[model samples]
Target chain A: MNSVFWTHLVKDLRIEWRSLDAIVSMLFFAGLVVVLFSLAFDPRAAVSQGIAGGVLCVATMFASVSALNQAWSREIRHQVMDAQRMTPSSGAQLYFAKVLVNFIFVTLVQIALAPFFFVMYNLHIAGPAWVLALILPLGTWALVCNGVFFAALSIRSRNRELLLSLILFPIFIPALLGMVQATTAVLTGDNDPWLWIKMLTGYDIIFTTVSLLLFDVVFHAE
Target chain B: MKKAAFTLFPLITILLMVWGYYQAIYVAPDDALQGYVFRIIYYHVPSASVAFCFFAVSLLGSIGYLAFRRSDPNKAQIADAWALAGAEVGVIFCTVVLTTGPLWGRRAWGIWWTWDARLTTTLVLWLIYMSYLLLRRFAAGPQMQTLAAVLGIFGALDVPIVYMSNRWWRTQHPAPVFGGGEGSGMKDPTMVHALLWNMLAWFCWGMLVLLLRYKVERRHQEYAELEAEEALASAD
Candidate 1:
């Protein structure tokens, strides 16, 4: 079971490593968003501090959509998903592997964006750096878990990219709010970062479990 | 008997709506704070409530469809019909709530919109279900129903979380205007009656619309099944 998970993960990683399609596009998109936002607002102003967290989360969310779609669309386009269905390995394993891969990809894009954000926005992290670090993965995990699940669900659709975003963004509001609020607290020197962290953790756990259990239904629905 | 029940529903709805409107405008006293603009509450509050109720129905139908899908295809079809009906009707009422809300807000809050907890949550709820309907429309295939059912369940699950997060976050909109704690709610019995009457009327009208929509969905499903069968026959 564990081997199955690792094999799938490695396969995806290798494909991404060779093509650099999803990661490069996501980074470029995130960079553009940061630049556009910087152009719109003077980073030296008070408003920048208030808007920074939201802008970062929004950029990540939009960029991750393309990455998530690519992750599933490649399998569907190549009939790889059908082949996997014939294998003895559980669908949940494949789901977990894809989710882990997506999480990593999103995290890397975010990491690449972080320095740009700091430079462009003239941002300062007032809270412990550890809080931002911890929040990054937890928040990204929550986003990508839902992203991958919905990507699979919408993979066979004609208008999947639009459909996936339409379905995902609304459901993503709570987690996005949590991440934005927590990041806001961290940047603005607010003391209650834990509240947002707890919310993010809870969001991640509930969504991951639900997505894992229901993935088989999505996979076998045809 | 079924036909009679169907015919009777529209009549009852019309009468209730007429009475409810009269009670709201003439019988119920104007609110001390907002005066006449508060009458919009009669429609706005009930529409929002009915919208939430329809979503609840959609959730139940989605669960039922998924649960019975393998064991009984017929039951699954019924569940799918109900889910479709609930979502369509829910979106309609949600539209009314969203529209009426801003109009009320324009007069009361002096702004057309606010990031108030209730308003934001309602907006999110509307988006989630609208996506559900859109998925059903465009994502054509045998798996569409199953996929839509999963989405329906997930959307419903997100509603409470959306509400909670918005509440914890700051809100610009007013707090619960009705059924809230002390200092909230109406004092006059007639106003209470008008509110309840409008709620009941809207619920009945919503159900009437839901039943009609369910019939349309049933017919659409039947047509699709027939087309598939004809295609298979021609291929053979």
Candidate 2:
């Protein structure tokens, strides 16, 4: 299982490395969103400071969706998913690998966008930087876990992109709320970042477990 | 017998609705706080409850569909019909809630909407089910049912989180009027009775809608089966 998982993960990583399709496009989109946000809001205003965290999270969410779509579309396009299913590796293994790859892709895009977000929004992290360090990965993992699952689920649809976004966004509300709140706490030096982080972690665990258990059903349903 | 039962449903529903409305308007005393505007509660609360109930039913149907899909395709077909019916009815009731909520909000809260947890969650719930319906419409082949069932289960899971998030994060939405801990009940017995009657009436109406919608879905499935059979026969 472990070997199968790593092999799948490496396969996805190599594909992305060779094409640079998912990562580059996601980063570019993320950057554009940040720039658009800066243009829309006066960075010097108090409202901008308040909304910076939310805007950054929203941009990341949109970019992650694109990356997820790219990841799954590549599989569907090349018939790689069909090939993977023929392997002895369980659907769970492939799910986890895809989730990990997506998590990494989204997180890298987020990291690339972070500097631009800070510079464009004129944002400063007032809290301990460790708070962000903890929240970023956990938050991204939660988002990608759902993303990868929904991306796969919607892959068979006629309007895959629209269906994926429509289904994914609403289910993502709780996590989005938690991440935005936690990020806000870190940015504004709010006293209770831990509460939001706890919520995000809880959400991450619940969704990851649920999606893993259900992935096989969805994978073979067709 | 089934035809007779179907014929009886509308009569009962109409009677209950008329009685419930009378009780709401004439029997229930004016709310000391919001007065006439609070009457919308009788409609809005019951619609929301029915919506929630239908979604719950849809969840069960989805579970049944998924559980029996492989072993008993017939049972799965019935389950899928139930799920389709429940979701369609649920969405209709949800639309009522969404509409009535804003009207009440505008009159009582002096705003069209607030990002309060319940309102936001309700909106998300509507979107979730709307997505479910869209998926059913657009997704192809035998896998569509299973895929939709999975989404139905996930959407059901979200309701609790949505409710909890609202409870934990206080917003402009008033705290729960029922089951909310501490100081959340009607003072007037007549008002409570009116609310109860309306809730019962709405439940009956919702069930009737579900039954009718289920028949429609069953027939639609049968029609599709016939078409497929005919196509195969002609090809042969």
Best by lDDT: 1
lDDT of 2: 0.88
What tens-digit string does per-residue lDDT give for candidate 2 at A61-176?
Answer: 98888888886788776688888778876799999999998888888888888887777777777788788888888888988999999998998989999889999999988888
| lDDT, candidate 1, A1-222, per-residue tens | 589999999999999999999999999999998888788875675777778998999999999999998988889766888999889878999999999998899999998888878878877777776788888788899899999999999888879888889989999999999999998888887667898899889889999999999999998888
The sequence of per-residue lDDT tens digits that candidate 2 reaches over residues B131-192 is: 99999998976799999999999998887787677656667776665777677778788989
Worst 10 residues of 1 chain B by lDDT: B170-179
Fraction of native contacts, model 2: 0.78
Task: Identify the candidate with maximal DockQ.
Answer: 1
Model 1 misplaced stretches (Cα beyond 4 Å): B172-179
RMSD of each: 1.5, 1.5
* CAPRI verdict (incorrect, acceptable, medium, high) for model 2: high
In candidate 1, list every pair of residues with a backbone clash.
none
